[model samples]
Target chain A: MGERTIIPFGPQHPVLPEPLHLDLILEDEKVVGAVPSIGFVHRGLEKLVEKRDFNEMIYVIERICGICSFIHSQGYAQTIEGLMGVEIPARVKYLRTIWGELSRIHSHLLWLGLMADAYGFESLFMHCWRVREKILDIFEETTGGRVIFSVCKVGGLWKDIDNETLKRIVTVLKDVEKETKKMADVFTRDYTVQKRTRGVGVITYQEAIDLGAVGPTLRGSGVVQDMRTLGYAAYGDLVFEPIVEKDGDCYARTIVRVREISQSFDLIYQAINKIPDGEIDVKVKGNPNGEFLTRLEQPRGQVVYYAKGNGTKYLDRFRVRTPTFANIPPLLKMLPGADLADVPVLALSIDPCISCTER
Target chain B: MSYMPKSPWLVHYDASSCNGCDIEVLACLTPLYDVERFGILNIGNPKHADIFVVTGSVNEQNKSVIKNIYDQMPNPKVVVAVGACASSGGVFRECYNVQGGVDNVIPVDVYVPGCAARPEAIIDGVVQALGVLEGKYKNMVKVAK
Candidate 1:
C-alpha cells in the first residue's frame, strides 16, 4: 500500500442527493477500503408512532423519504389494514398501484438525473430533470402536493381521482414516456456513460445475494427477486417481469431503472384501464392489536415495514427497513477495488437515499 | 444591485430532513425552475458560499456542522431555512435528537415554510435572502467606515 490516506467523502457533497459520508481509504488514487457513516439526515421518525395515533402515523411515516412518500403511506395503510382485517375496494387497490407506479417512475427519473450529474453530464442532468418536471406536474394535478403527497390514509385514500382525470393522466404519461425514452437512450447508448459506469462497480450474482442487496441492485446482478411479485396491492393483476441485467455493474443498475420506468408506465396504464368503480375505502373500526410486516418495492429497492400496535390509538413500535440500508454492504463490497475517482458514481449506482436509510 | 458583486453562490446542508426539502431545493436548480438565470450557483464548500441554504431541523450531531458552515461563511452572508422542519422542526421536533429549527443553532434570515417547501417557495426565499444579503453588505461597509 503506497502510503494509505483516509479521506472523508461526505455528509454533504454536490453529487449526492442526501448526506451520506464515507471514509474512503485510498492508496495512489485507488480505493483500498471504504466505511460508510450515515444519520446526517436521520430524524428518528419511526419512534413518532408512539406519539401519533395509528390513524395519524401514516403522515409521519410518509415523511420517511419524500421520494417514496406515497408508497410509505401505502405500505402503512396496507399493513394496518391487514392487521385490522380490512379489505379495501378493488378501485382503491388499483389506485394505490397506479400511484405507486407513478412514484416509482418519478423516483427513477430523479435518480437518473442525479446519476447523470454524478458522472459529470450537466446537460443530460438538466434534460432528465426537465422531463421529470412533467411527472411532477401530474403529481401536483392529482395529489395536490408537489412533493410530500398526503393523499393516502388508513383503509383507503383521502382523495379519489375522477375517471376523466385518470384518463388524462394516461395521455400525459404517454408524452412523459416519449420524453423519457429520448433521455434514457442517451443513458444506455451513450459512450461516455458506459465508460464511466461499465465494470466500475461490479458485483457478482452470488455476491449480491450474499450481501443481501435488494431492488435494482439485486435485479441488476441477475436476481429475479422483486417484492411486487408478492402482490400486496393491484400488482397481483398487473403483468411485468423483473428487469434483470447479468453484468451487475453500475451501467447494468442504471439500465435497470431506465427499463423499469417503461414498465411502470405500462403498469399504470393497466391499472387505470382495469380500475373498478366503487367506494375507495372501507371503514376501519378499531386500532390494530397485533403486529404486521409488509414489504413494498421502492425505486431503489424493497422497503420492509414492521408495525406493532397495542390496540390503542398509539402503536407500540414502528420499523422501516429501507433499501439503502440493505444496499450499503454491497456498496462497501463494490468500493474496495474501485478507483477513488469512481467512488461517487459507484456510491450513487445504488441510489443512496440516506434519509430513507437513516429514518 | 450595486452592492452585489456577482450572483450569489449557495452552500446547502441537510441537517436532519427527510430529503423532502432537499429535493425541492434541487428542483430549484434543475432546468424548469433554473435558479442559475438569477445568477445563483450551488456550490459544495461552505467557505465560498454567500447564501447558506439549510434544509431540515437542527439535531445534536449536526449542530456543530451547522455552526462550522455558518462560521466559515464570510460576513454579509444570509441563512435561508427552507421547509417546516428547518423552520420549526415540522414533525420531528419531539424526537430525542432534534432541537427544532435552524434558528436554535444559527440566526436565520429567511424562513420558507412548507412540509417540503416547494421550489417556487424556495426561490422566493432566495430572492428574500438576496435582500437580506444586500442589507448585511451595507452594514459591513458602514462598520468598515
Candidate 2:
C-alpha cells in the first residue's frame, strides 16, 4: 500500500540535538508511521511549582534536563526527601551515589556522542566527544555547575566531596575508564558502527513490555528493568546491576549505553570505596506536607518524580515523568516499517531529551 | 591569515533549547573542543551557511524556524547567540512559549553566555564569529564599490 508522504522529523534537524517533532509517515524510502510532536522545549517547568518554594524548588528541578541535570536534582531531591521526612546523611547517600554515577557517565557519553553524530560517524563523533571531555572534567571538579549541577538539595547535598576530592574522583574515573574503553571499541566493534546500528530499531521483549518501555529502552528489551535496581539513593548499600541487552535492536540500544558506561565505572568504584563519614545535609524544618512518588535512573530512562506537598511554602504539584516522556510511546513503537534512513538512528535510540520531554 | 575565510561554515540552530546548549553546540565540533581547528565546519545547510550558530530561546514553535534560518544565511552572515538560553531566555525565560532571547527574534552578533555554554565558551563564540565574519566581509566589499 505504498502511497504516502510526509517528512518533518524535528523541531530542527541535522540529527536533532533536542526539540523533537517526528511526523515521517513516508512510503518511498519506507517508514510508514511516526507522529511524535512535543512542545518545543516547554519551560512551564511544572509551572515552576506555584512559584518556587519547597526550598527553592531545587533550582527549578535542576533545570529539568541539561542531559539529565544531576538526575533532575536527584529526582527532585528524592521527592522532597520523601515528602519532608528528611533523613539524608550517610554522607548524603554517598554523595548522591557519587553524583548519581557521575551523571550516568555524562549521560552515556552524551548518548554515545549523539549516536556518533547520528550515523554519519564524523570521526566516531570526535572520539565520542573526546571521551566526553573527561566526563565534563568530573563535572567541573565536583559540581560547581558544568551543566546545571546546582548540587542537588532539598534535605541534602549542596556540595561535599573531600578525601582529596574522593581521591581525585578515583583518579578521574581511571582516566574516564581508559577513555571509555577506547570509545566503547569504536561503538561495539565498528564496521561503520555495525552498519548503522544492527537490526536498526527492533524492539520486542513483548514490544518492550507492551510499549511502556523505560530506561535503556526497557533494558534493551530483555526487560530486566532498572530504576537503579530500585534501591534509590545509595542504591540500598551499593552493588547494583541492570545493564541487560537482548538485542531489541539499534544494536541493543548501543549495547545498553555501552554497558552502562562500564556500569558507571563500577558504580563510581563502589562509591569511592564505601564512602561513609556523615552529614552532607539534613536541616529541613517544614513545608512539603505529603504525596511523593519518586524514581531515578536517568541518563535516558526511568525518571518519574511526582510530588504534591500542600503544607505551605507553596504547596502543590510538581510532576516530571521525563525518560523522554516514557520513551515516546516506545519511540512511536520503533518507527514502523523503518528505513527513512532509519529515522535519525531511530530518533537517536530513545535518547531524545526534548528538554526532558517538555519540562 | 590572508583576509581570513578559511572555512567558517557553521549553521546549528535549535531555537527552543535545553539540549544543554545543543550539547555544548555539539561540543564545539568534538575532539576536545576542536572547533574544527578554526575551520569550524558543523554544517547542515542554511544555504551553505557562513556562521549562524544559535542555540535556544525565542519559542512559539521556534520563532518562524528562527526567522527561517536567519533568512537562509549566505550573506556576510554572522549570528552566534549560543546559550544562557541563547542569551536572555536563559531559564526558559518565564515560559509560556518563550519569546525572549536570540535578540527576541534575530539580530544577535555574539552572546554565548553560559547555563550550558561551555566547550570553551563555544570556542569563544566561534572566535567571536570570526571577527564578525571579517567585518561582514568588509562591509560586503564596501557595498560592491
Candidate 3:
C-alpha cells in the first residue's frame, strides 16, 4: 500500500445500468476514497417542464428514466393534484398503489438480476430476469408500454383497470411472489452471492441518515423511515411495514430489496382485492394556480416533486429530488475502504440510476 | 468432433444515454426475459468481453472510451446498438453533445429499435449476435482444422 492508484470505474460499465463515473482511489487493491461524477444522462427534464404545458409535462416527467418512470410521473402528478385540491377516486388511488408496487417489484427484480451479473452469477441473473418478464407482461397488459408506462395522469390515471384484469394481475402476482421467494432464498444462501455481497459495503445507521440515504439503502442501515409510511396514495388503506435490516452491509441492502419485493406483492394483492369501482380520472376545469410540494416513495427511495403553476397552461417551474441523487453522497462514503473487486457490487447496492440523478 | 458454443460475454457502455434505454438493457437479464440462458453475461472488464452493447448516442467525451472498449474486446466480437438513440440518435439526435448514432463511432452488428427498447427485443438482438458468433467461430475452426 505504498502508492495509490486511481481507477475510473464508469460512465459506461457492463454491469451498471446508468452513467455514473466513480473515481476510486485504491491502496493495494483496497479502496481509500471514492468520488462520483454524475450528469452524463441529464436531458434537462426539469427545465423542459417550463416549456411544456402542465398536462403535457406528465409525459415529459415519465420519460425521466425508464425504470423509475411511473414513480416520477406519479410524484409529479401528486404534487400538482395536491396544489389543485383534486381528490382522486378511491379506485384510482388503489390502482396507483398497485402499479407503484408492481413497478417496485419489477425494479427490484431488475436490480437483483444486475447484482447477480455483477458478481458473475449468470444463472441467478437469468432466473431473476425470467420472473421479471412476467411483471413486464403484466405492465403491457394493463398499461400500454413496458418501460415508460405513461398511465398516471395529473388528475387520475389515463386508463381504468377492469375487475377481470385486476384478477389476472393478482393471479400473476401470486406466481411472481412464489418465484421471487425462491430466488431470494437462493440469493441469500448461495455461497458466491454471499461472498460477493455480504459486508462488502458497510454503512453505519448514523452515516446513512446523515448522508441523506433513503429507501432500502437507509432501511438496510436499520432506519425504518419510508415515505409510504406517510400514507400517500392508497398506502393508507394497505397495512404493511417498511422492511429494515441492522447490518447495513451489501447483503443487508439485498435482503431489504428482496423482502420489499415480497411486500410489494402483498400490497398489490391488497390493492387489487380492495379496489373500488368508479371513474378513473376527474376533469380539471382550470389551470393550476399555486405551488405544491409532494413526496412519494419510488423503488429507489423518496422522490420529492415541486411544481408551481401560475394559472396558465404552462407550468412556471418543476423540480424533482430523485432518490439516486440523494443517495450518491452516502454511496460515495460506502465505496472507500473496500476491495477493488467489490466496487461494482458496492456501488450497485445503492441502486444508483444516473439518469435519475442527473435529471 | 463436436464443437462447444461460444459464450459471448457482454460489456455494456452508455456513451451518452438518458438511462431509459440502459434500464431496459439491464432488464434483458432480469427474471422476466433472462438473456443468460444463451450465455449472455455482463462483464465489467472490457478485456474479457466478446460483445459490446453500446446504448445512447455517441458523444465527444465518451467516444474515445467507446473506441477503446471496442478495440480492447478479444477478436471475434460483435457490437449491438440497443436503442433508437444508439441506432439513429432517436430523440437526442440534434443535441450538441450527441454525435449521431453509435455507428458513428463503431461498427454495429445488430440494431434493437425502440425509444427505450423492451427487454424481449434486447434478448432477440443478443440471439442474433450468436449467429454472427457462429460464423466467426466456423472461420476459426476452418483455419485450425
Candidate 4:
C-alpha cells in the first residue's frame, strides 16, 4: 500500500445536496475506511414538541426533510392518531396514501437526477428534473406548497382533492410514468452510468441485514421487507409487491428505486380507482395519554416514529429513526476499498438525507 | 457598473437547512427555472465564487463552517440568505442547537423569505444578489484608486 492519506468529503460538497461529512482514509486512490459525522443540519426538532402542541408539531416534523416532507407529516399524524386511538375515515387514508406516493415518486426522481449528475450525465440530470417539475406542479396545485407541505393534520388532511382533480392527476401521472421510463432506460443501459454505478458498492444480503440497512439498500440485497406491506393507510386495501434486486450493488439499489417509482404510480392509480366517497375527516376527542411507535415506508427507506403523550395538547416526547441513520453503517461498509474518484457515486447510492438523519 | 465581464459564480452551502430551500436552490439551476440562462454558474469552490448562497439557520456545528466559507470568499462577495430559516431562523429559531439566521454569522446581501423559498423567489434573490455584487464591485474599484 502507498502512504496513507486522509481526504475530507463534505459538510459541503457539490455532488451532495445535503451535509454529510466523511473522513476517508486512503492509500493512493483507494479508500480504506471512512469516519462519518452528522449534526450539521440538526435543528433539534424533536425537542420542539414541548414548545409546539401535538397538533402543530406535524408542521415541525414535516420540515425534517423537504423532499420527504409529506411522508414525515403523514407518519407524525398517523403516530399521534394511533396514540389517541383515533380511527380516521377511509377517504382520509386513501388521500394520505396518494400524497405519500407522490412524495416517493418525486423523491426517487430527484435521486435519479442526482445520480445521473454524479455520473457526469448533465443532460440526463436536467431531463430527470424536468419531468419531476410536473410532479411539483401537481403538489403546488393540490397542496399549495411545493417542498414543505403541511397538509397532514392530527385528525385528518386539511383539504380534500376533488374527483376532477384526482382524474387530472391520473392523466398527469400517465405522462410522468412515460417520461420516467425513458430516463430509467438510460440509468439501466447507458454505458457511463453502468461504469460508474454497477458493481461499485456491493453489500451482500447478510451484510445488509446485519448492518440494519433499510429501504432500497436492504431491498437491493434481496430482502423482501417494505413498511408499506404492513398495511398502513390504503396499502392494506391496495395490491402491490415490493421491488427487489439481488445484486446489492449500486446498480441494484438504483434499479430498486426505478422500479419503485412505477410501483408507486400504479398504486396511486389503483387508489384513485378504488377511492370511496365519504367525509374527509372525523371529530377527534381528548388529548393523547399513551405512547406509540409507528413504522412507515419513506422513499429512502422505512422510518420509525415514537411519540409519547401526557394527556395534554403537547407530546411528552417525540423521536424519529430516519432511514439514513440506519443506512449510514451500510455506507461505511461500502467505503473501504472504493476508489476515491467513485466516492461521490458511492455516497449518492445511499440517497443520504443528512437533514432527516440529524433531525 | 455598465456591464459585468461574466455572470456571477454561485456557491451554495447548507448551514442548517431542512433542505427545503436547498432543493429549491437547486431547482433554480434545473431546466424550467434554468438560472444558467442569465449566465450564473454554480461552482463548488468558495474562493472562486462571487456569490455565496446559504440556506437554513445557523447551528453550533455549522457556525464555524458558515464563517469559514464566508471568509474564504474574495472581497466584494455577496451573500444571499435564502428561505425563512436563513433569514431569521423561521420555525427552528427556538431550537436549542440553532443560533438563529445566517446574518448572525456572515453579512447578508439579500434575504428571500418562504418556509422553503419557492424557486421563483430564489431566482429573484439571485438576480437581486447580482445587483449587490455590481455595487460592491464599484466600491472595490473606488478603493483601488
Candidate 5:
C-alpha cells in the first residue's frame, strides 16, 4: 500500500458541487495524504471593497459568498456600526436574529441534501430540498432574493417585518418544524445514514480546537462554543444552548446540524414573540471613523469582519474571515487515512464554501 | 443505434463566482429535481466529461484555465452557461477583472438566467440541451446514411 498513486479529486467533480481541487495520495482505496488547491472561484471581492463606498459595500460584501450571504453582510454592517457607535434599534436586532436563524435552517437543509446525494440517498436529497424550497420562498418574500438576502444595512435591517408578516412566519415555521423533525429522525436514527457517516472523518475535541474548526464541525466534537452565545444581534434574549455532540465524526456533525435547525426554529419563534415596536434603522450622519472588529455566528461558523474607515464615504480597508476558510485546516486533518470513497462526504460535513474561503 | 439518450457526464467549472450560483448549480443535481435521472452526472475531470456547466463570470486569472477546460472537453461536447454572472456578468459585470459572460471565452449552447438561476430553471436548461444533443446525433446519423 506504500506504493500508492496520487489522484486529483477535483477542480471539477460530480460528487463535489464546488470548485476545489484535492490531490489525494492513495494507497489502494485509502487516502494517505491530501493537498487542497482552492481559488477557482476567487472574484477579487476584497479588492472590490476598496472601490465602493462603505454604504454600497454592504451589497458587495453580501456577494462575497452566497451560502453565508446574510452573515457576511451582517458582519460588515456590524463592524461599520460599531465604528460609528450607532446603537441599532431593539426591533431590528430581533429581526436580524430571525433572518439569521432562517438562513441557518435553509443552509443546514441544503447541506443535508448535498450529503444525502453524496452517499447515493437520492430520495432523501430530493425530500430535504423539497422542504428547503419553502424556506427559500420565505427568503424571497422577506428579503426579495433567494440566495443573496441583501437585507442587512449599516445601521440595521433594510426592511421591517409587520406583525402580520411575523404571524405568517410563525405559522409557516411550525409546519416546517414538524416536517424537519421527521427528517431529523431519519437522518439521526436511520441505519444506512449512520453507517455511512458515523465514525467517518472522526476529529477529536482537542484536534478540532487545535485545527480551528468552527460551527457544527467543531460543536460536533464536544465544543459547546457558539459565537452567538456572546449575544450579538438579539441572540442574548433567546433561551437556548449551542448543540454539541461528543463523537466529532461525520454523523455527529450531521446530528448537530439537524438538531441546530430545530433550535433555530425555537429561536425564530422567540424573536417573533419578543420583538418590540421601534424604528428599524437610524439615519447615519457621516462616514464611520476608526477601526472596528465584529464577529457573528453564521450557519457555517464564526465569521469575523474588520473594517478601518477614514472620515470618507469609502472605507480604508475591509476584510472578512469566513467560517469555511477557518474550517479548511480541520478538513485537511480529517481527510488523510480515510477511504477515497468517503472524501466527498467528509468534505461536505465541513460544508466547504470555496467562494467564501477564496474570497 | 436506437435513440438512447446519452447521459453526458457534466464537469462544473467555477471561473469567478459568489457561490450563490454555484450552490444553485448543485441544487440542480440534488434530489428534489434530480438531474441525474436524465443521465447527467457531475465528473471532476474535464477529460471525462461531455458537458461543461460554467458558473460565475470568467475572471482574468482563471481565463486561461477556463479555456483550457473548454478545450479539454471532447469534441461534440456542449457548454451551458449557468446564472446571470455566467450569462451577462450579472452583478460583477462592471468589475475590471471580469471578462464578461462565459460566452466571451467559449461558445455556450444554453443560458440559464437568474442572479443565481433556480434549480428548476437549471433543470429546464439541461433538458433543452439534451434535445439539442439528440438533434446533433440525428444529424450525424443522417450523414452516415
Candidate 6:
C-alpha cells in the first residue's frame, strides 16, 4: 500500500486558460480526493450594480468572463428587460438569436482547441484556432470587438445588421462549418486523441443529475437539459432540440461541443432567413421595480442571472450562477480515483471558466 | 545595447483577470498571428523565459505568485503588462480584493492598454520588451567590467 500525499494542482498551470486551485490528495499516481478553491479572479462585479444604472450594467456583466461575455450581457439584458416589462420588437429578437449562436460557435471552438492542447496536440490546437479566427473576424466586422461584443443592451440590442450584411455572415458561417467539419472528423477519429480522452473521466447519468451539472456536461451525460428550450429571445420562433449524448465520459463532452458548432450554424442560418425588417430597439422608459431571473444556455452550460431592482436606475442586487460554478461539484466528484495525469483533462472537460465562476 | 537574442521566450501569467487578455495573448500564438514567426515562443517555465508577459490585475491571493514568477526568471528579463487591467486594474479597480495593476507587485517595462489588448498590440509590447532586454543585458555587461 502506498502512502497518500497532497499535491496542489494550480492557481496557474500551462494548460488552464483560467485560474483554479485543486488540492489533490494522491495515493501514488492516482488521485484519491480533491479540495477545490476559488476567488483568485473574483472582481466583485455583482456589487458594481449598486453604482451603475441598469442600462450601463450590461458592460460589467459582459466582462464577467471574456469567453462567455456576450451571453452574460444577453442574460443580464433579458433579465432587466423582463423586470421593466419592456417588450422589444421582433427584429431585435432575431438579431439577439443570431449573435447568441455566433458567440456559442466561437466559445465551443475555443474550448475544442483548449481540449486538444491539454493532451499535447499542438498542431491540432493551432488548426482549430485557425478556423476560430474566421468567427472572430465576423465579430469584429459586425459588433466592433472580437472578444467583448458590447452590442447587447437592456431594451433590446445596440446595433443591427442589414440583410446584405446578414447574408455575408451566413456565408462566412458556411465556410466556418466546412473547416469545423474537417476538425470534427480528426477529433472523433484520431487515435491519440481518442486514447487520451475516451473513457478517461466517466460520470454516470445519475451522478450528473445528483451533482446538478448543466450545459454540455449534463447533456453529455444523456440529460436533455437546455435552457434555450425555455424560449428566451427568438428561440420560440425557430425549431430547437437539445443535443444529447448517451456516454458520460470526456469523449462524450467533446462530441457534444463539436456537434453544437454545427447546430449553432444551422440556427444562425434559420435566424437570418426568417428575420423580418423592423426597428432593432424600443425606447426603454422608467426603472425596473421588481425582481426577475433569466436563464441562458451558455457554451459551457446553463447560466442563471438574477436581478433585483428598487424602482430606481440602480439595481439593488445582481447575482449570476455560471455553468462552471454548477459544474465544479461534479468536477470534484469525478476527480477522486482518476490518475494524476488525467486531472488536467478531467478539469477541462467541464470547460471550467474560473473568471465566470468567481465573478 | 547590441545583444538582441535571436529568440525571445515569454512566460504568460494571469494574476486576476477576466481572461480577455489571456486569450488574446494565446491568440498571438495561432496561425493567423503566429508570433513564432518573430522568434517568440510561449514557454511555460519562468526560469527559462527572457520576457514575462503578464495579463490581469494584481490581487491579494495572486500577488505572491506573480512575484515568485518574476524572481524566478533569469537576469536581463523584461516584463510586459498587457491589457488595461494589467496596466492599471481597468474596470475592476474598485473591487475589494484587487490590489491594483501588475506594477504594484513587480516593475513593468511596457504597458499595453486596452480592455482586452488586441493581439497586434500585445505583439508590439513584446517587441518593445526586446529593446528593454537588450538595454538590461548591456547594463549587466558594463557592471561586470
List each candidate's DockQ score.
Answer: 0.78, 0.23, 0.36, 0.88, 0.51, 0.76
Interface RMSD of each: 1.1, 7.1, 2.9, 0.7, 2.4, 1.0
Residue A281 deviation, candidate 3, in Å? 1.2
DockQ of prediction 4: 0.88
TM-score of chain A of 4: 0.99
Using lDDT, give the best candidate's number.
4
The CAPRI classification for model 2 reads as incorrect
**RMSD of candidate 2 to true structure, Å:** 20.8
TM-score, one value per model: 0.99, 0.34, 0.87, 0.99, 0.91, 0.98
- lDDT string for model 4 (A210-278, tens) is 999999999999999999999999999999998999999999999999999999999999999999998
Tell me the tens digit of each residue's lDDT in model 1 across B31-134.
Answer: 89999987899999888889999999987778888898899988879999999999999988888777899999999999999998999999999989888899
Stretches of candidate 5 above 4 Å error?
B1-11, B29-51, B72-75, B93-97, B120-145
Query: Over the stretch A92-193, how does candidate 6's per-residue lDDT look in tens digits?
Result: 989998888998998899999999999989898999899999999998998999898899988878889999999988888888899999999989999999
Q: Let me know the TM-score candidate 3 reaches against the reference structure.
A: 0.87
Compute the lDDT of residue B127 as modeled in candidate 5: 72
What is the per-residue lDDT of model 5 for residues B103-139, given as tens digits with 9 covering 90 to 100?
9989899999987678788877777777766776678
How good is the docking of model 6, by CAPRI class? medium
- CA lDDT for candidate 4: 0.92
What is candidate 6's TM-score against the reference?
A: 0.98
Pitting candidate 1 against candidate 3, the one with the higher TM-score is 1
lDDT of 5 by residue, A221-287 (tens): 9998899999999999889998999999999999999999999999999989999999999987788
Q: What are the per-residue Cα lDDT tens digits for candidate 2 across A171-256?
A: 87897798789888888897878998898888889988887888898889898988777788788788867888898998888888
Model 4 ranges off by over 4 Å: none
Which residue pairs in candidate 4 have backbone atoms (N, alpha carbon, C) closer than 3 angstroms, thus clashing? none
Kept native contacts, as fractions per model, are 0.74, 0.61, 0.45, 0.87, 0.56, 0.65
Q: Which portions of model 1 miss their true places by more than 4 Å?
A: B1-6
Q: Candidate 5 chain A: minimum summed lDDT over ten consecutive residues — where?
A: A41-50
In CAPRI terms, model 3 is classed as acceptable
- Give the alpha-carbon lDDT of every model: 0.90, 0.80, 0.82, 0.92, 0.85, 0.90
